[model samples]
Target: MNQNNKVKHPKGLTFLFLSEMWERFGYYLMIGIFTLYLKDVKAGFAMTEAEAADLYGTFIALVFLTPFLGGLIADRYFGYTKSIIIGGLMMGVGYCMMAIHSLPILYLSMTLVIIGNGFFKPNISTLLGNIYSTPEYEDKKDEGYNIFYMGINVGAFICNFFGAALYILLGWGYAFLAAGIGMFLGVGIFLYGMKHYRAFDVKKGMQQGDMSFLKIVMVILFPAVIAGVIGWVVPTQVLGHALIGSPSTDAFIFACIPVIYFYGSLLAKADKSEKRPIAALLTIFAVVILFWAVFKQNGSALNTWADRYTDRHVENPMAAKIFSGLSLSQQLTMAKDSVPLYDEAFRLQKADGKVLQEYNYPTYFKNVAPEKRLAEGTQIEVWATNISQSINPGWVILLTPLIVAFFTWLRKRNQEPTTATKIAFGLLISALSVLVMIGAVYSGGNGAEKVSVFWLMASYGVITIGELFLSPMGLSLVSKLSPVRITSLMMGGWFLATSIGNKLSGVLATLWDTYENKANFFWINFFLLLFSALVAFMLLKWLNGIMREKGIK
Candidate 1:
């Protein structure tokens, strides 16, 4: 290509960015409302917080877990482009099917998404690495990944507003249909750039001694199913109150054992030159689980915090009008006679030791003073709960450029931190973000009152910095360090760690009601990240040494 015609990066990057952007828009839109849908009294399943949290955790965990098989299949049989198209179509159809308001269909829809994500997630990332592998783009690989990461957040940031608008204006079904449309759009965008990625869409066929596809299915998939079944059917009384919080929780943890072993076997069997780097990646993967466990709670525990504890009522008429026009406001009718009573989990607040019978009580006003409360039966508008899902992605959108610029400045000054170092600091910084929530809890009088929405925004801002440091670095590290032949497979391993942490996040959220004092709950999250940070810091020298040996930054 002529110099003027040649792009600074691959033309494929633009296509991949838009494609992934739209895909995430669909995925996040569905996730942003998932728990809310499950817990809605009239329109939803009316599940308790614990029940909803468990299902949400299991759904996200499986969503990330399938990439291992997908990457393996793409590496061995299908190419990246084909797998991406198939996965995208499957997810689109699945999202549409979710519009059917039946429990069986809901589960079936979730299954389709889980399987679809497997085929789509890791391969797209691996393809991006392949495009950047050439000498022309090699030096800019990290920057390329950062830019791509920003695209994901862009989709994530924008989707909630659309989801909120659709849910408010049309209904739940239309909002879900919108997710499906976004996925189909993503697939169309990917196909448009197929020719650009073709040169780099090389598949690694079966290597010598690699297991056959059938054997992998038999050894990994079949055993996982059997183990999950056993975990699910085994009595909670057998273990005395559920071994790991719930049957699904137990099943997922049990299922992961074999997959964890599979990754370990890969390390054990690698040639000497590849062994240490694989080990380093695995070590980092193990530690970062804590970061994800806390971060993923934005969907479950944090969503609850936003719904019941944050001050979401709009006092400014202009702001209310704007939000109303966007279909992002929830109208509450204040009725003193309709106040809800506390459930067993305390999710609903009670008055005068009497259980209230009314449905759709305005629980958001539970903490308000009597003098400030609206007249009985008067209607007031507040922003919807799921809109809070936008905060982290909003931070990502604002701070990513600043973060990239700061690191670039450090690089120019020869003072840039190593990727491993950035991740270590990321863990520590994320731990501190948990402290912001602890402060919020205490400031709000242990959930007895509504706290300022700024607390949630500040917490998200702090954690977004940590996320920028760690998440993209992990992806870049896999690309930089993995054996070229197993790049996609190792990416799968990175996501496997994420999968486990995501499930654990749900497990923790299920316990949200167990803590009478909510500040203690956040303190526990802080300590988990703190411990992980300590471990990462201790291993920093060894990890950097491995990078140096491989001649990478």
Candidate 2:
């Protein structure tokens, strides 16, 4: 247990991994309940699904967008450890403020998290890469990132239970408060381990031929601010609020224009040596956007499916009791009679005595069949829908070791696929996960029946493999390929791709209400993924060539 002489990965790596794990646990916990909390009529915001998805998309997109600046600032002025601590605190406080429920306060809180993440997320990851850059651990960089990535999923996996319990036990506000607490704990852990990584947190201090910080602020940050203002102030409802999209969404998309331009400007201004690295990074970033677009739907549209369509009732006594007690159970039943519910299709209708969409307290039971339905007078205390969000992370925790070992074996044989190839294959395999949803559609006959939870589980299982393949490798690739001076900034670029894709996923999910045939929804996801995979496959040869030329392979 000697700290400095740790075998394989560095001690700093483990500390950072655990820090990120807890931070992500809190972040994902907040996200897992976010839209659901918004849409919950009782003890929730009572927003429609579409409204909630739009806001969720916008929030996540902006959360990622800020890292572009954060990374740059860290590389130039602020040290990595400092940035991470500040960012973590900001996010922790934001989560706590979400408990307030005031619109202005909620917005202020979200802004804090977004800005805080910009500082914390990219810098810690860059610091990890910096630690691995040492000659001793250099060979195991990819493995380091893979192991680090498992921490993220570990947090994501465990947060749902906490979120469900806090929300069910107390209320949505308390659940949100829990997220803040988790974030603070993460910060505390990271600070405790600061000595482990403090040596590597040195600032690069504006590398040779790099863009001057002030110039970037003028050209990029200022423009982004102006664009956001225009988007926000322009009367979307010129006469009434008739903008094509919501103000928040339009503002975010507009803000991205300047930020996107800034990244493009990097390519234009780069020296010959830097150009290839930047070009390579951009190509990979563009291709992976699709993977994120589909994968991130777990929050919006897919959550709705698990909440409404998937039959989550556990018949097994042990499992059912566990889930029910954990506040993660879902109850499903069949409503033979036409039930009055508040949906977009019948929003204006007033049939039931209760004005708000009133039906069976347990919404899942409404669409299920009699045979499968719980006996009358028998109340099934089932798990919460948000709990399903944990499945992918659960799989990641289970499968990462096996996947890592498989790759390690491949490395020994001098036969490991390059990171680019792994990412390409990940995209292809992720496309397959969508088909499972398509199957769920057919099996359930366009929502005329209740689909088995197995379909949801199976779809998640397939996607989790793809996720393990792509996500960890994507981090490894950026770390490996990026020039030392701009390492964290490139990571920001990677997150930028994710930001755009996250928004697109939200856009795609929001369209769920528009699709009459459920299969069409999944097909769209499939095609989007297929197209992304094809693009990645097309770039594989060139990317591999770069990897080999750089002596990274």
Candidate 3:
């Protein structure tokens, strides 16, 4: 585990790190602006909250689903390196296609990106784990994935700034072009590392007693597709609707039924020695879905908080200079004049028992003096809101080193928690981040005033810590516990958990407009996390036994 244990870590690690950094850079840049792009009157699609949330949810849900297919292919035929290259290229192309702005092209582009991600996402992690499986690097495996996660967030953190610059200085097309450029750079970085990882990226080619590729396609993929179609046509709440949040989400949820069943069947049929380990991993995966459902809202509901409720007023003359000079700050007019921000797609009742009326979303600018509206004209200018997406990734880059060192200290003293224990605690901590927002609700007083940016910042900071504990550790846990032959397949299971959570995040975000008191919105998230945390904590003793039986400790 020590640096001195080997001459050095593999060069592939550094190359893959840079590659992932740039890929995430492209991906996050798009996501940071995704909702804002949908809702923009002049430059965006002019969609309402429910519409955008549905699309965003469906987009991310499908994004995670592809890994299910991608992992299968890489495990059998294409191998890891080729799959990564192909996946990266497809995604880069998809990023470029976003510039076209046509809905049909958008769907096609999303399909490409989804398939690309499926092939690319899980394999890279599996590849990194394979590299670390060697004795020289074995002890440092957790640190390796931590560093890798940092690369992802570094890309995520910096991309928003680029997104801001491109959008402000030019237009949406230019910003999307920037994303495409970042994606290509990631591919270049990945290609540079090919020689280093060529040996480890070997194909499994189906071992003895393993299911054949054709059988997986016929029994799993084909059946899942048929079932998804049935789910689409079925007259059920989970389906039977054209809304982004309905039939599509339902179809997706239903599609997962076969895949989920397949994993369970794998366990039912697992050899006696492998049963405990697989069961424990599945247990953790199921519990953590709630965590991701709430956590993934960063790009949706939380993003809305930063855009609307949070007071983005940049005082401190020097701080304004720094942000404004770089085009990263949101500048707004102080005049009493209304800018007519249109967030309300549905009707709302007046507070004083008047008839129902839906109007432009009232802004914090409404709080300014009426006379100031004259000098500012009837409309006001405010800095763009998409830039706030950078906060979480910023926290990640700042905190990863400290967290790793803290855990290292714990390990040395034999005080390290079991992986399951760390995940349980992660769930608990993630729950508290919701409470931070509940405080924001209390402070904002029903949007009569803008909440301070610090509230959102503080919330993201706390949640980032929980994300660190859960996310990378989830990857490490799967690698550590999965049977070697099925590692990538199991990693797909982890992403499957994430896929379901992401879809649910969209479903949750779509409810934002319905909540008359946004504080209750966050309270709902709080309870969801609390429930999941309780479930994990209650099962901890049983989970620990399985971990012990499987020799995971």
Per residue, candidate 1 scores C-alpha lDDT tens digits across 65-141 of 89989988998899988999999999999999988999999999999999998899888988999999987888778
Q: What clash count does candidate 3 reach?
A: 7
Model 3 TM-score (2 dp): 0.88
Which lDDT value does model 3 have at 278? 91
Query: Could you tell me which 10 consecutive residues in candidate 1 have the lowest summed lDDT?
Result: 340-349
Local lDDT at 1 for model 2: 31
Instruction: Encode model 2's per-residue lDDT on 1-553: one tens digit a residue.
Output: 3543465778888789989998998899999989988777666666766678888888888887888788888877888998999999999999999999777998899999999999998788889989988778777787788788778988998899999888887888998999999999999999998888898988988777566889877887799889987777675746456254567767767878888887888789888877887888899999999899899999998898898888776768887778775654443333336433322133322442223663444466656664665554455656788888998888888888888799889999999999999999999999999999999999988886778878988999899899988987898799898887667568778988999899888878778878989899999999999999999999888888888778985
lDDT of 3 at 451: 69
- Candidate 3 local lDDT, 451-530, one digit each (tens): 67889889999998998889878977898889876776788789889989998999999999899898899999999999
The 10-residue segment with the lowest total lDDT in model 2: 340-349
Off by over 4 Å in 2: 1-15, 129-146, 233-244, 269-277, 328-362, 374-376, 480-488
How does candidate 2 fare on TM-score? Answer: 0.88
Q: What's the TM-score of each model vs. the native?
A: 0.90, 0.88, 0.88
The numbered model that scores best in TM-score is 1
